[model samples]
Target: MTAASIVDPMFISGASVWPLVEGGKGVAASNGTSAGAWAAAGGVGTISGVNADLIDDNGEYVPLIYKGRDRKARHEELVEYSTKGAISQARIAHELRQGEGRIHLNVLWEMGGCERVLTGVLEGAKGLIHGVTCGAGMPYRLAEICARHEVHYYPIISSARAFRALWKRTYHKFGDWLGAVVYEDPWRAGGHNGLSNAESPDQPENPFPRVLELRKMMREMGLDQIPIVMAGGVWHLKEWMNWIGNKELGPIAFQFGTRPLLTQESPIPQAWKERLLGVAPGEVALHQFSPTGFYSSAVRNSFLNELYERSERQVAYSDDPSDADGRTVFLPYGRSNHGVYLTPADHARATAWMVEGFTQPMRTPDGTLIFVAPDRARQIRRDQADCMGCLSHCRFSAWKDRDNYATGHQPDPRSFCIQKTLQDIAHGRGDPIDNQLMFSGHNAYRFGQDPFYKGGFIPTVKQLVQRILTGE
Candidate 1:
């Protein structure tokens, strides 16, 4: 393959540099060390602001310990830790860069206490962070926050409709500080995606059309000069030559979230990096199992498979016998509750599952009951009881950050605690391949075919950047 001339530099955050950026990976995957090196290579580097890791003055990793009597207290502690961690990472990234490239901090708008954490980090870090990139929700207040701090803001969006809504609602006033709009493909992106109900996960749409549509909308709104950072499924610049210098699309940049995982500077554990080499095509699955109630893409490993099985073991139920689709059947759950009403077929299925040791029946918000083994049921209850309110609203724990602080429904058993799993995977506290959520893009399988990674060769951040510029 011939290397394309990627000499067109773009100005972002007071610097004109290569229009390439490192997409932020959360839960300690993208840290200060890696982001700093990316910026040093003359590209935008993104530091994850989702419970980022921090180090002590003695050079030891500071363990995040939450000692709260309840979820509210734990949430407070989480925000404090998150803010401090972001500030620490920003300092380290700035020091390492020494004023080269640009450093952007990424956060999820759906994350618990988002406002508090954003304010805290921006207040503490000050000039260290040049821009803030937010995704996973319609962050209407992000522009205002960035403007107040005199920092640039990039709102990660999936559709033109979403961007228009943001611009019309709150961003129009602070339009100058609006750095760029990141159009992360919801169907193919790693981590939690923002696919609405109108969009089907089974059918993937072409990003070019979607992005071009976005540019059209932006131009109509007088945002013609702003760059659109295309994220998700972007592996090579050569493949995207048509998007480059296209007057209709305007200024554009590419954000890589998966390719950089194998770099030497990547903060993920060695085992996780090695696992990437073995990923084959179609190994990644996009599903709605996140506690945040949003669809996320991840490797179909043991952890994801277990969640699938748990959901499969579920059956809908009714409070009265007559509501059981006319043909009423009693599903004897436990010795005390007697059982709920179900159809004859469902009753037989439930009986079979119970015989197979799935004796524990649990209620869900959608008038369904999922049966699991006694041990698994106990674990689920424990996890729910130990909810830390990591998300603004959790499907697994039914915990909300506002009002009564409850979803007013039973916690669903199909989902698991995202915070617990992400923390475990990031810290290498358990099996890397099994037992934890492994966020990845559908294009992750290309790792095996890429010649740059032939014979299990892992490159440094600088080497990876140079190779990418070669249009490989």
Candidate 2:
């Protein structure tokens, strides 16, 4: 490949650095150490703001423990903890960068207390953070928040339609501070995806056309010079040679989320990193199981398998017999006069599941019930009861940040507590391999075949950056 095929150092939102960037991962996956080293390597580093970790005065990590008795109190503690953690990470990253490169903070708009957490971090870390990259919802207020902080803002979108809606609604007024627009391929990206009802995960489309659409929209709106950061499904610079300096997609940059996870400076546990080396093709599954009600891509480990099976072990039901199928039978569980109406076929299936030790049947908000073991059922209930308002609207617990803090629906047994699992996995507090939510992109399997990582060599952040610059 020609030298021009590789990305050259350029100015991005006022910071001069290599166009390469480390995409943010949540629950402490991408932190001060990783982001700092990446920036020192002359690439843009993104520190995750989703429940980040805090460091003590002696440079020791501080474990977050909630002492509140109720959800409301715990939620308040969560906001406070998140804000402090973000600020601490920013400081560490800034210090490590030593006035080189740039650091950006990433947050999910659907995250609980997002506004409060963003305000606290930006205010607490003032000039340390250069930009804010946000996704997972239509973040209309993101521009306003970044404007107030005098930092650039990048809105991660999956479609041109989504960007158009944002620009028309809010981003238009704050165009001066628009740093860049990120186009994360929903079906291929790791972590939580942004696939809407119009797009199906099974029907993956070419990112070129989709990104061209985004560029066209940006050009029409007078944002042509602003770079469009292409995220998700990106592996190496050589594979994307045509996209480099393509005039049709002016000022394009590539963001790497999965490739950097195996570097020496990556903060993930050793076991998690080893797991990445052995992943096979098609092992990562894109499914709708997040409490935020968004599609996410993760490894099909036992944790994901259990959730998939839980949804499979479900049957539709109705409060009134006449409202459902012709066969009406009282659900032999719950209080008297609270029997649900179910079909004869579904009743038989439910009975068989009960005989298999899945005796506890829990109702979902969508007129269905799933059977689980008694202990599992108890754990689900406790998890739901101990909700810390992690999301603005939680599908698992039926919790909302506003409207009296309730969604007015029965808790869903099909979904699990994301806060508990993500925290558990990130901290390595439990089994890392079998029963944890491991987020990854579909192309993660390439780790095994990539020649740069032959003999399972894990390079340092600097080495990795140098290797990437070779157009490998």
Candidate 3:
């Protein structure tokens, strides 16, 4: 894909930089090195503040090792770790940026103790980060927090409606610090998507109309000067030539989230980079199995396949014998041999599964039992026990940050421990890469199809940015 279209420099975060943004990825995929390199290349670089990594004074990587006895204590530990990691990464990015471009911190609003982590990092690393881009939820307090820190705020929204709610509720008062509006296409973006209940997962809307709506809303709110960062599925600039200088979508920029993963500056492991080139079209799909309760797109590897199969082996059971189907067949689950009511067909299925080594029937929050192998069941229970409160409220573990520290429901076995799997994949830990979660944008398939990336050639951050500028 080629075009003669040119992208002009845009003013963002008190600086004039290329209208190219490095979309932030989580679990150490996009870190200080990558963000700094991207900023040095004249683009707005983003450091993912989600469970970022840290380096000790000796310049050695310090592993995240939790020492808490309980989930609450570990949750506190995670907050501290995130705060320190963000500060450390910001300092690195600030130093490597050479006083050019902008360094923005990206965070998920659904992360555990998000406010505490953000405030703590800002307090510790003052003046290091020029802006903050947040999404994964309605972060109504983000604008005020950024204003207090004298940094710009970029709210990542999937629709104009979400941006309007934020502006009216909180951002309007701190309009001075509202740097940009990141329109992350929930249908095409990687990691956690921001699709609202009104949107359909199977139907992907054209981004042009959605962004136009957001720009119109901003214009009505006297925010026409604000730029809209188009993130997700942005592979070639030529594909977006029409949107470059479109008046209806004022002050636009493209954020390359998936395209940057294969760059030399990317913090992802070499194997992960290689794996990206092998992704085929239709392999990545938006699924609602995340513990955060948000839909995310990922490759259908063995890890995801297991989750898919786990959900398939489910059967709803009634604890009360007076169910509408009457006193039905019994399913003896758990070590106590407690019996639950199951319909005749479901009973047959459960019996077949039990015979086929799925002897463990774990209860879900939705009053259904999902059968799994005994070892798998134990792993699920262990992961639940080892939860560190990664999210504000994790449906998988029934761990909520407020009230009784639980979601008032049984822990679900359908979802795996995201923290553990992400950390494992990021650090190239013991698990095989296929058994861990690997995030990728819907356009990851193009990496293999594109000739520039042929023969395993990976370009530097500057090279990648320059190539994108060529409308390739």
* Residues 412-446 of candidate 1: C-alpha lDDT, one tens digit per residue: 88899888888888778865556689999989999
User: Given candidate 3, what's the lDDT at residue 165?
Assistant: 97
TM-score of each: 0.97, 0.97, 0.97
Clashes of each: 0, 0, 0
After the best TM-score superposition of candidate 1, give how far the Cα of residue 88 lies from its true spot, in angstroms: 0.6
**lDDT tens string, model 2, 149-189?**
99999999999999999999999999999999999999899
Q: Name model 2 segments beyond 4 Å from true.
A: 1-5, 335-338
lDDT of 3 by residue, 385-409 (tens): 9999999989989998877898887
C-alpha lDDT values of all predictions: 0.89, 0.90, 0.90
Better of 1 and 3 by lDDT: 3
True lDDT of residue 348, candidate 1: 84
Model 3 residue runs over 4 Å out of place are 1-5, 322-327, 335-337
Steric clash pairs (candidate 2): none
Find the 10 residues in a row with the least total lDDT in model 1.
Answer: 1-10
Q: On a 0 to 100 scale, what is the lDDT of residue 396 in model 2? A: 89
